[model samples]
Target: MVDWSGGNDRGAVPKADAIWAGVARGETVEDPVYLRNRKIAEDWIGAFLEDELAAGRRVLAGFDFPFGYPTGFCAALTGQGDPLALWDWFAEQIDDAPDANNRFDLAGQINRDLVGGKGPFWANGLKRDVPGLPRRKDGYVNPFPERRLAEGQAKGAFTCWQMAGAGAVGSQVFMGLPVLSRLRRRFDAAVWPFEPLSAPIAIVEIWPSLTVGPAPSGTIKDAWQVAEIARQVAALSAETLTQILDVNAPEEGWIFGLGFERLLRGTPAPLRNDCFALPTGVHWTPVDEAMELLRSRLSPVTGQETVDTADALGRISAATSFARRANPPLPNTAVDGYGFAGGRPAGAQVLPLVQGRAAAGDAPGAVPAGQAIRVLTGAALPAGVDTVILQEDVTVRAGAIHFQGPIKAGANTRKAGEDVVAGAEILQAGRRMAAADLALLTATGVSQVRVRKRLKVGVLSTGDELVDAGQKAAPGQIFDANRPMLLAMIRQFGHVPIDLGRVGDDADALRARLDSAANKVDAIVTSGGASAGDEDHVSAVLDAAGAMALWRIAIKPGRPLALGMWQGVPVFGLPGNPVAAMVCTLIFARPALGLLAGADWEEPQGFDVPAAFDKRKKAGRREYLRARIRAGRAEVFASEGSGRISGLSWAEGLVELPEAAMQVSAGDVVRFIPFGSFGT
Candidate 1:
């Protein structure tokens, strides 16, 4: 496996972003070889191949660059759709040296002379301006699609048009294809998906990121990726390797291990740490940064239970479920018709009637040649019969049936395993089962499933100024809305809600309530007194007991969050205000509780809708506004005040604005997340 680079050479010392190659033979893998430049890398690869071939070994070499552009690009460039011809064309046009190349010039020439447009390619990363190459995609237009079919299948892969930005692979395509073409010609190598994988040497396109994982300490990431992929690929069985290469991508080449990436996934990520602890230097975490920390540090805390499939609705699956039996389970007629050994007929045809009839749950029977038997819908097709003619399409006569000409085989027949195959994965782990899922599982003969036990989450409210609703309020006391709201929200999140009720601003009382709730529930949600204020008994009590750690998240409406553990139970201390408390729970606690309850940590699904209002947002903090989608556009609340409790009822969801300074005009697309998507 070769990690290709398109940049200038580095010095003799090994570094990242330089070309590196890893070789594997059987179960053994060699240390990655760092090549300083493209020319040197090509020479080194050629030498390695020659040595291997001379020793009578068949070699499969993989390079991390796109082997072809989008479907129509090669035809537009070379008057043909052959990717190999495009590779040769690139080899003819490009010039390479240790420090420089004509890749930018060739890209410009192709854009102007061949395709006759400004771009599909852009972002010339050169100091000097290159003709026909733009620095940004703001106004660029392309005659062809920006991505290939493989790019759509693999998430986060950049289009080949992006040449000079972070994660761009276009430069590598321009510089690497020529070398590949030359190597193919010199070694008579078969380029995968274009030609059969039957040769002494086979070359394939690869994207290393598909199988990348954490690198070991003191190991270069590029080197680790190449070495790991090489070892994994070399260890694949012949049948598995053949399956991985069996993709229909002749025009636009496929990534070598696109679908079979698990074979290359070196190791699983470790489980979450024992406590909610942030890194030492992290003071105020950005929204994305905080989420990444949580994703890497959190795992399931609940145990699994076996439940009947009929009782599995709204429960998280503990493991993936496979179909015990196919949905149809046998070849069956799709309608009330005659089953017969069907064949193509030029005109009308007639078949003699058989002695018996077939219906649902009938024993297996056979039909004589040129004979038809009466069959009903859901009836298994009798032996020696492969087709059925609909009753409406045929005429029943004396001991015979008549049908029209040009009748196709297998018409109106439901084949076995058509809807679902036995032993195939039917339900994934971490899925929250619903009514439809139960029906599917029952149909596939999955009687019971392993599911996670529901998490018991307790809700508590602090501060002396709050009183329960429906009670006569004293002076300066407001009704306690956070507890009821939080309790309901917890139930909506598919967990058992335990109301811990209210506690005053006394530290002793707060500690007692937390201790008692810790023994009763799996986790606690406290909505008031989470900060370091004089009346913040919750944080002070947990902190004095060495259980609290404050997280200053850089998000609007919700900034200070207190996370801690008491008696082995996690506590999420949200803001005292109602709006901030709700937002923080939806944004952070929902996914956190999901992880603790044995479900996958999932972000709320968001959609891009046009903005109905205009605003200017500043950097350094992410902001989410209470908003609703109306007529395909998202409109925020009239007020940004956190005290406006009515706005929560008025809006359907939240419009999330990113942490960047930009002017959002009316009709600009903005990301909107519905409250229902977060299960609230």
Candidate 2:
């Protein structure tokens, strides 16, 4: 992560307010490097992110300040719905020239444009009086909320609304977004929740207050604050980092430690030589990093067997497959026409039709000089055959066929191996064979194929309050929706689902159930009982057994995930809430199970569609709102609460909100993932 500054150059000395950068890789966080100017900072950040990414390491970067405005402010000011778009626009509007910048002038211009002459922005640090901008807060109406959501959450957090106050972050927002926009564009990095979570470089809006507490007497506050942040980030375990990345608030960005604020202890990670001490404070993990770590550690199912080509449809190939034979095994006719030989145009004038005709599977005798052979589509081309002409294009009279003028040579003639060559790779390993693949294989004379063994997955439903759907729910009990849903999804993905049924919140019972299923299944999946509650016993069991890393992902509707090994069999624990459980199963567990089942990583490709409604979200966390496309725009479910099971049921798919503070207007582009894309 890189610390940022928004102030102008601080003469040759880098002051506390000036931008200082610190990079933390594992346990070692380098000293805060001074960047005297914005230009130097921009170029340095770009180069650093690139260098880190190029080295094949994932970069979880954070910038100090609000990456976006509070809710609708960005969309209102710029007429752009996307948060990153606002960043780019803000960056382009600002003119930072090292020694001096137009921060006050830009503030005045923004105030004029947003609120006419009287404005919410106040306090001019500029020595000169700027028109429209105020010297201090007076009677001007504040168009935006007094503080961002995160600022409101954090006690003593500075107000970003003020332009010139002691704790004002107005300059930071104005100056910071421009550089961030440039960095994002230059690196093609993902700006948190706005983009898909696949990019190598991820930029986040960081608040130093998130990691720093009240300083002691005689301490340099700024230096100590920067050091504290570097230490905290350095101590971030893979699991903790994963959880942080999981919190994707694109529009209303979240503070890094919003949820984990209580978990933060000043266990600083020390700076050493090149090597870093084991990552400390490993309480949470980011969703993306957890997935990669899971994928890298999992070994694909080893069983392989041959299946008849008829059964190859929807089966993943275990090895690279090649064609048994070339398509059109021999030269054949492509149309119901006459087969023209060497005498082509000479015979075109008037050629004697061959007595023996070539129909499907029948070879006609070679045509002699000045002769034509009558052939039907798919009929084998006889010796000396060059082309086939459609019967409609030729007129047959008195046993002689006359063709149209200027028929190209070899027209409508299908050559052997034209479609597919023998011994050529047709299907790759780990490909879930489609119907088209089977049809192609059959056409190439393949009778059987080798495919990975189907995954035998055990599905369990945990929660004492969960009852099967067929049974009536008793008091305080809810229907077990996740189990059936997960089972159906597993089956739809071509894996055999082993139903473990509904297990109560008893940890011993859950552990016993897991032990029994260990040898019977390749992997185990449980829905519910993974979150932080008195009833959340699933994570407690895993933690006690030292079985897996529990995940507190930064996603709405689904945040709790437990992954571990039970008696050598990998197990995935989903959230207790039905909607969150389903989402976690689909997004994380599905890909993970596929990897274990010997399938390549299959991610649902999202389409960009306009939003049908206005959405306000903070930066630093990702929320997948249950939504559907209507009239070419994405409309989210009225409620995005995690426990709302009906939301997922109503949605055709999900509208992914990026990590940032944004107020999305109707017709704004949003990434949409359809249910059909997820096989289940």
Candidate 3:
């Protein structure tokens, strides 16, 4: 562990707030070393790593400063969203020495020329002013978020913008990153999460405060912190180390041990297994009624697990997720222009400009009376600033801004809590987390959440004339297509799929397969032998198990739907034909699996569109024809046969014909359901 410093060299004697390094090996930890300056520390670290690598030993070195800036700040600086690129850029620009360095000047140049100026880096501790650098935190504007995702989770952590005040870390980052960039090039070292975790030399960003305790009397706090943190990290189990390294922050590098605290606390709760027994006595049921029955009777059977927000997509929220902090955390500008406090003006007006501009992520400053300050988009609005005028509407002449007004008092100003308020629920329980949801959750300071465990749904195909795919089939046998199709569907619906390979038609074999699947998966979906024939073993086995319900649904291409429980696990028995099986799975099993996986019970919505073909049918049973939209009209496949598997691939969606069928003309409007509505 390295406790880095950005100040000038501390001569001869060892002291606190200076550079310190602690090394730990198996069953041994060496005394901390104090390096007087950056040049000395860099030389020592490089030599130490080289010797360790020569001895064929792996070394994990850590530094205490931030590895990268906030998300957009890197892209704005390097023209790419890469932290290493920014590191290289800093290495090329910054010139460091033992006593005097150009860090403040570089920061000023970055603020003024590189990015639209004002401030992102501030607190220039020099006696005289540098061009674009500010003497106080409130003087500069930031063009990015104030903190990274990792920083948001780390309470009491200082933002990497304060350069030379108490708890300031900005100066250290500006100095340390350049050294790391050079060392990585010298020794091809992997930085965690950005580059995969690997052998010879690896550098990680760490915060010793997370694990350090009170220092021993008379010992330097920085030295004690580095020693203890290094020892702790070196002693971690391989599994724990891998978990800590398995993060997804490339641009904004993650802090070591930030989200893995709970993992070391305890094991997770066991999964729940409540048998979902379907109701009996349903003969020739309508599609709507069947759906309602499933929704009312089924509930989630999976337990919950807490995961980092970076890995939470597609998981179902276990509880309502609330914002930890208000979004727009501070009131900010909505456009690039000038901000000033005053009521709407009548016509043309001119005001003196403030010395500096304001950008996003910078501390909010106060605007003087009758004065305007240049503000970039997302920049925090200065105090006394209630409105902003677009740059196109203004002209700069004689050190003053001139613009025609009558603009609203709060125009182009986004208020704090404008998007989300702190403690307000952002996602409700049973909602499937999406990409956009992650953005909202992170921006509001939500780092981790409890999500339902993915449900493992097994697919089993049974028939005497069946063979697995990729094998030469015998006479009178065909490759099993239902298993692969159903497995993909299970994954598409956000559930885990377990393949329970083909089983021949036999009562004992079918029973054994069902019994094995009950222990391995949360639910089983078997295609074939669903009807009550002498050879139909799926329904026969369910009947023998004493929890079977065969629903004769009033739908074409699908009718015999068998629902049952086998050894405490639910089972959905579908028809053998591929086309019929797919239709039934979408209509009945998709929503059921979603509910079992802890998501809301969703019904696929359909809309009416013009029909391109004309047909007449009797009014007894509902029908769904495999169709696609052509010229804004529904055009169905040539074949309506259940055995036409090619039709399933050819059609984009299904056109529904109601129970009271009265279709006659080609111009008639028909209800069409897209495959995407079923999450395909």
The number of the candidate with the highest TM-score is 3
- Each model's lDDT: 0.86, 0.76, 0.85
Model 1 residue pairs with clashes: none
**In order, what is each prediction's RMSD in angstroms?**
23.4, 26.8, 21.3
Q: What lDDT score goes with residue 680 in model 3?
A: 93
lDDT of 1 by residue, 152-228 (tens): 99998889998898988999999999999999999999999899989999999888789765675677989988976
Error of 3 at 100 (Å): 43
Instruction: Summing lDDT over every window of 10 consecutive residues in candidate 3, give the lowest-scoring window.
Output: 264-273
Residue-pair clashes, model 1: 0
lDDT of 3 at 433: 93
The better-scoring model by TM-score among 1 and 3 is: 3
User: Which has the better TM-score: candidate 2, or candidate 3?
Assistant: 3
466-563 per-residue lDDT for model 2 (tens digits) = 88878888999988888888899999988999999878979889889988898799888888777667777777877677665667677776777777
Best-to-worst ranking by TM-score: 3, 1, 2
